[model samples]
Structure formats: structure tokens, C-alpha cells
Target: MSEVPAYLREGYITPDELFRKIPKPSEERLRARPVAVPECPQEIPCAPCREICPTNAISMPTPNDLPVVDYEKCIGCSLCVQICPGLAFFMVHYVGDKARITMPHELLPLPERGEEVVLLNRIGEPVGKGKVLTVVPREKTKGDTPIIIVEVPIELAWDVRAIKVVRE
Candidate 1:
């Protein structure tokens, strides 16, 4: 029998599994500008990410279909990031040697812009350190889910999905 998907087995999609299930943004796309990267691997009934996209970049043939992002049409706006009910959408933008990752932030004591944070991967494992670049307040988002942008090494961009704010 075919093996169970890693997302089902491990409760989170591993990088390898994610790349296998969805097309990774082309290198040319990554260097162009910020783009929405949906990590939703499950075929469950969900479509807010696609519905709320202002650029019509995210598309799903049906409610249960996995999201497909048209990188070229994406404007890199964080609307998808803020609207996704599962918090599966992210924005990746490379600037020189560093990359900015914009993701939904629901944790308490939100990190301020320029604050240092511990970057975490899909399974909540610490991957590296990064700095908060921007925090879109909840008042601006559709569901009141705040969004934050953290800058990390370009190499860690794809792996850094969440952050842990260390309070002094």
C-alpha cells in the first residue's frame, strides 16, 4: 500500500514532502519579489486563502482542492497570510542575502519590529534566529489574525515558518 503522507503521520508536512506535493517557487520567481506560498497539503474543505487573495494568484478548482498559487500574478500582499484559517499561507521575499518571511502571528506578547526571535520550522522545531521586520495589527486583517514579517538568512527562508519571541 502507498505510505501515509508525512503531514498525516507526523502532524506536519516535512520540507521534502511539501516540495513533493507542491511546486516550489522557481528561483527566478524568488528573486523577483515577495510571493505567497501555501503550505496546505490536506484536501480538506478550505478556501479562504484562495478567496481572499487580492491578486487572484491563489486558485483552487474546488473547496477541497489544494491551493495553487500563480507566482507571476501574486503581488506578495499578506492577505492570504492573514486570512488563511489554518495559518498555512506565507510570504517569502528575498532581499540581497536575507529573506523576509511574512506569516500569521497568534502568539501572545507579539514581537515588536526589530526584535529578535527564534525561528521555527513546520513541526515547531527551532531552526534559526531572525528579526521581526513588521507586525500587521489584527485590526487590519480579515479574521483578526495578526501577521508578522521576520527577516532571516535566505537559506533559512523556506524552513522558517514560525517564530518564538523571547521576552527579557
Candidate 2:
């Protein structure tokens, strides 16, 4: 079996615990529509996103702080997925009438391109059906990264952040 990281094995690390420790936006601000390009919340040691940016849109002056991404210049190449150890990077394209989102999908029985799948929201709730546009397997990716790009309705773009293929 793969060994668990020291932090996780020691019960000293958890996604929720880390999020809770970070400052959050106000309730009123949370209700407003999020910007196309979201800001990073913590000063964590991560620079892969910056280095992976083909357009040089992301900048990280320090290793511990979150990198800044310039959305206007970003090309949505999904290169960050290959570099981020936390798998925290994603690409959102809202200009094609429909919204195209590319995210890192690490799971078994990977879906094929053009397959119809159920899109899920940030809370892991089913929202709608989305068509897979591309499935970049680990072999094609820089490492063990599998990039899944899906296209969904423009209105549901922001709501649908992930996908689960329906079993036949």
C-alpha cells in the first residue's frame, strides 16, 4: 500500500481544517457572483501553477504564498494540473456560448472523450449533463495527471464544477 503523507497519517492535516484556518469572504459578498478569475486565499508553498502557465499569467514571488493568476492573459491550457501537487488548479472558459471547464480527474475507469456524464456542483451535488470534450490520460500528461475537459451550458457553467459518468 502507498504510504500516507506524514501530515495525513499523523491526523495533522485535512482539507476542511486548512480551509477553516483561512480567512473567508463575508456572507453578503459570498452571495454575489464570483469573478471569472478567483483569488487564492492562503500563503501555501506552491509555485507549480505559476511555472506551468504557458502565457505567464500566474506569478508567485514567494514559495509559501498563493500565486496570482491574470485571467485576461490566461489561455486555459490546463498545464497547471500536471504540476500542482494539491491538484488545486482548474480552467474556466465562459466565452463559447457554453462554458468549458477543464479539471484534474484522478479516478478509476476513466471516461472517454465525447461521453455524456452528469455534471456536479461544488458541493458534490448533481446538476446536469455535460459532454466530455477531452480526456488527457496520464501518459499524455506530464505525470500521473488525467485532465478531463467538459462542456456545459453557459448558465450552469459556474454551478457545474465536476462530472460523474453514468454507468450504462
Candidate 3:
């Protein structure tokens, strides 16, 4: 394949993009609860994340533009994460000691709540272990992709995006 244009490269948004967009919530704000981090970097025309946001946290006037999010308004509900066809949204919650990170999970033999699993990084490299907090199916994902919430160390939470479960 030919070299991907810089603009097209943006389509492959990653956790790093989400990290950059994450607003620094004050200790007081953090106390209030969670917020969302959108990693959608594509210049393509897509706005499901914006339209599906119940709180109007994500907004996009034109399909060609990237969605804008109101950090304070975002509830970290992970609805955008599940509704995004590009699988570009991630909900992050920094709590007392661990971070509640939710990402889209489409694999079969889904992980169960309270189950232990091997955590993987952005590139799918095993990092550590985490406990499944919840497994949201398509029934509740706006008829789109399902989602999973995991509890891990705040440090690893930002890097870990995928998990491994022994199906055998």
C-alpha cells in the first residue's frame, strides 16, 4: 500500500489521542465522578458518538468534522464507546485507588463480572491483570458494539486497552 496521508492517518486514533484530550479534573471534580475521553482522530464524516450522547457531551455540527465533547457534561457512561463504529471512544474514571476504564469488547465468550483477566496494552501486549467490573452487551449498547468495564491500577488503566481470557 502507498503511504497513508497525514489526514487519513488521523483516522486511526489511539489511546494517546484520548490521553491528550483528557481534561485535568481537579480533586474536587474527580470527587464528583467520571468523564469521557474520545480518541476519534479521523477526519472522515462520522458523528454517532456525538449524536448518541445522552447528555450532549459529544457534539458535531457536520459529519466531516470530529466531534466535540463537553467534559463536564460527559457522564462516562460509555455509551459513545459502544455506539462508535470506529471503536474510538473510551470512558475513564479515576477513583480512590484504581481507575475504571471502559472499552468496546466484541470477542465471544465474553468476560464475566468479577472475573480475573490478563490486561493488554494498546497494541495488544499483555501488561498485567484486572478484574471485570461489568460486561455490557449489544442489548444496552444502542444496538451497536458491546462494552466492558475493568478495574486496574490508575497507572496501567491508561495503557491497558484489551484483555485476554482463557476460553478453554
Candidate 4:
């Protein structure tokens, strides 16, 4: 068997490797729950999530260390989602039939509820189509960062992060 490649097309680790490296707390429980998942794999010196967390759920041992979520302490407030400068913070809610993914929306013409959009992966590949379940504008955000909630298939929850909303 060959070892995992040093880098993929996106110049980062593979999805399987990333999942193995990152700790998921939501899976430990059975009930539907919301959890914060940071896709930051680099050792960059940033700590906005730790500084802005009202519950002190995110821990940063050093400046360069990426944010680690203490799922027990996280209240699913999505403050980190808005405060994350790199737009790497996302919250996922695993519901009965769908998964709600909340992501930072800095682009113009924000998405709205009931709008259909193309779901894309980390590498800009269209995974599937999803429906916009909710949209939080800048004014309603904690850090003035607009966020949109899209409902996708339960299985695509982890694979789908961002959406391509059609604009006229």
C-alpha cells in the first residue's frame, strides 16, 4: 500500500486524512446537535475565534495554533462563524432528513431562503444541489458577517460547505 500523498490538487491534505486529523465531537452523541467545525489545517498565527468566543469554547495554546473547539462548552451560537477572518468556521446541524450548514457569506447578493443553489466542495467541485433554508444578513450577525443556511442531504453534510446561488 502507498502512503498518502503529501499534497492534493488544492495543496493540502486529503479529505480522509483531514477527517482523521480533526476531532469530531458531535458524532459521540446520538441526538441531533449543532457543532462548529474549523477547516483551518495550517499553523497560522491567528486567534480571533478564541478571543471572540463568549463561552470560551475554543482553545488556542499558541498564536500559531489553529482553533480547537471544545464541543462540550460550545453553545452553537455561531459567533466564531462570523468572527473567523479566514472564513473557515462552519456550524453543522444534523437533523432528521437534512443537514443545516451555516457558512460565512462575504460575496454580494446574499442567498435567501427557499432559493436553490449549487453545493460546492473545498476544491470548487459541484457536489450536488441544495435549497437555501435560511439567510442571516450582516445586520443580524454578531460580527456583521452575513451567513446562509442551506439544507442538503444528510450524507453530504460534511462534503458540502459553500453554495453557488444563481444571480440574474
Candidate 3 lDDT, 1-168, residue by residue in tens: 898644356434354455454444455554467666666655688887887788987777789876767878888777788888877777777777888888888777789999999998877879889999999887877747778999988878568877888655
Candidate 4 vs. true structure, TM-score: 0.86
Measured with C-alpha atoms, the lDDT of residue 15 in candidate 3 is: 47
Error of 3 at 136 (Å): 1.3
For each candidate, give its TM-score against the true structure.
Answer: 0.95, 0.71, 0.83, 0.86
lDDT, candidate 2, 16-71, per-residue tens: 44345433333333233221232234567767677767788776678887666655
Model 3 worst lDDT run, 10 consecutive residues: 5-14
Candidate 4 clashing pairs, residues 3+ apart or interchain: none
- Root-mean-square deviation of every model: 1.2, 7.6, 3.4, 3.1
Q: Residues 131-161, candidate 4, lDDT per residue (tens digit)?
A: 9988989898877679888888878887887
Instruction: Pick the winner on TM-score between candidates 1 and 4.
Output: 1
Q: Model-by-model lDDT, in order?
A: 0.88, 0.65, 0.75, 0.80
For candidate 2, list the clashing residue pairs, or say none.
none
The worst-scoring run of ten residues by lDDT in candidate 2 lies at: 30-39
